[model samples]
Target: MNETPQKSQELKKVAECLYRNGNKVYFALVKVRGKQIKRSLKTDDMAIAKRRLAELREKAERLHGKENKNIRFEELAENWMESIKASLKPKSHDRRRVAIVGLTPFFKGMPVKAVGFAEIDEWRRKRGASISARSHNIELETLKNLLRYACDRGILMDNRAEDFKRRKQPKAVVDVLTRPQFQVLVKALYASPIAVASGAAAMVEFLAYSGMRVGEAREVRFCDVNFETNTILITSGESGTKNHEERTIPLFPNLRNLIQRIKAARPTADANDRIFQIDSPRGALPAACKRAGLPHFSVHSLRHFFASNAIENDVNFKVVAGWLGHSDGGMLVAKTYGHLRQEFSATMAQKMTFEGLSDTPPTFAVVRDAAA
Candidate 1:
């Protein structure tokens, strides 16, 4: 028979004693907000049951900050994700999905507040030995973000990822081309007989010259080109937008002249047509490398090459960072390109004429005795 829960009726504790397992299980039938609630205390002793009773009393006392009864972390995660997904971009939404991919299994059915350092450490342990530090570090950052989301929505009391003790990995350094190398690459780009049509030559040259991203170059339109002001308008779209922030970059006279030459050849490109359609900006350089017989170059490396050249030539780091569309102030410039300055300084040290240093003739001019 079903019985209604009441605060006045006085709840009863039921104990089930098992002889085979030598375990004693205990539960209480009580009323909370006029509904009957049965909570089981899984233990094998009276002392444990008594301790659990004290814990239940303490939990009941702290109603404001405790995790909700029977609510799972996965359920909370689902609710939290729905609120943020509507505000993020498709790419950003996809990235968030990636952050949570390898994390779902461990914390799925657990309570929102149950995730702690120990549980996280166990999840990481299951990943086994082959995991790289870089990827694991990214996972840690992602886990922190999820906990931060939980705390923001009153699902968790605190962000515990801050307390985690993991070793920080040094960032990977990307190589940039020196001035002679960049010049060689540019010359190699324009070497082909049909280079004008390939436009790979023009595209890479513009990237090297202007420091524009490859996608930005591809999505650039005719109307965005301001010959009078010598500027290129980087409009926002799915094809090429830097985190959806639109900004204009000024063009140099040399770049403008190259644009005119390209325009003279094409002559019929509409104001909004795609600029580089012959090949992907990424693939162009590899093909160019095969032809030029030079070391392979990545599209991103061209931008790095430009930035390093600017810094080596005594251009301000802030100016270089802005020209490269880096949003993280000039930290990228400071961290990566600072090493190139040493090589540049070394070049300066070796720049002297032989006019005054050695007017004396070589000792070979004075024939020595063969017996000596």
Candidate 2:
């Protein structure tokens, strides 16, 4: 009789029960109606676990009920985020996680079925007012992906977020540093006593010449360099690449010289060790720009400078695209750098010359005599 009473008391306080499984703690023994329920609260904090217990119980009540009115946008998003985290790189995972933060304030506790196209459109309109169209599109895309995941998992009848229109993004103007500006920036990097002596100038020059993204530059290893071929092998490192492809780029003279000096500084450095292990020269770069009185540009602008310069130098479009690791076979290069190509072509036209051409075409009489 006493044992039966104890069992009844335990069941009555189901939400307070907890258990540990391996290193992870879970809220266990939750019962709703005739069913038992357990869930991973995903944390060990007692306060957090208590809070989550209430939410879980509410979730169970709705899931078990005939009305099924408690399924929430936050719940679906949490499930979706967990499913995709393993497949994404750390940086990408963080980006998706950040997108959800903005979404949660408005939609977190709302039912999935309750959210409609108009609500999403209104959110897009309001979000676009403060952020760039590209940034707004990313947030919108994240919301759509979450809803689609819910539909795929049978949590929603359909994904209404998919019907929402994406904000139209304007064509971005590509800004590049001219040679004089690049020289000034380089001078600034080295002029600072704080700048690392291990090829800071070379690093800047390499990006300007090689068209390598900053991340790609940081991942470069000494073994990737081929002194004989005058080329550096570009590979998708552990983080993967922007397009998940690999290609080669010419190791320009200044970059090669700087790399040699860096290698000499670390004579025992392993071939697998990164050639230049530096973070974005954000501090040094911007400070240098300020001192030089040049307009601010990002590290990526160096790559644009390389591409623009290559186009102006009449490098074949296909060749330039390949060197830049673009898989589109130069279509994107043509779109972004076509105007530079036109400028170069016009400049070339002014100097056009023929080695073997008469000052004037043969007269019609001379042509008739030859025919006769």
- Measured by TM-score, the strongest candidate is 2
Candidate 2, 224-262: lDDT as tens digits: 999999989888577766777777888887668878888
| lDDT (0 to 1) per candidate | 0.69, 0.77
Q: Provide the global lDDT of candidate 2 against the true structure.
A: 0.77
On residues 254-353, what C-alpha lDDT tens digit does candidate 1 reach at each position? 6687788778877888877766665445655777677767788798887887787688788877778777777877887888887787778788879865
TM-score per candidate: 0.68, 0.72
What's the lDDT for residue 140 in model 2? 87
Which 10-residue span in candidate 1 carries the lowest summed lDDT?
15-24
Candidate 2: TM-score?
0.72
Model 2 segments more than 4 A misplaced:
1-70, 353-372
**lDDT (C-alpha) at residue 344 in model 1:** 80
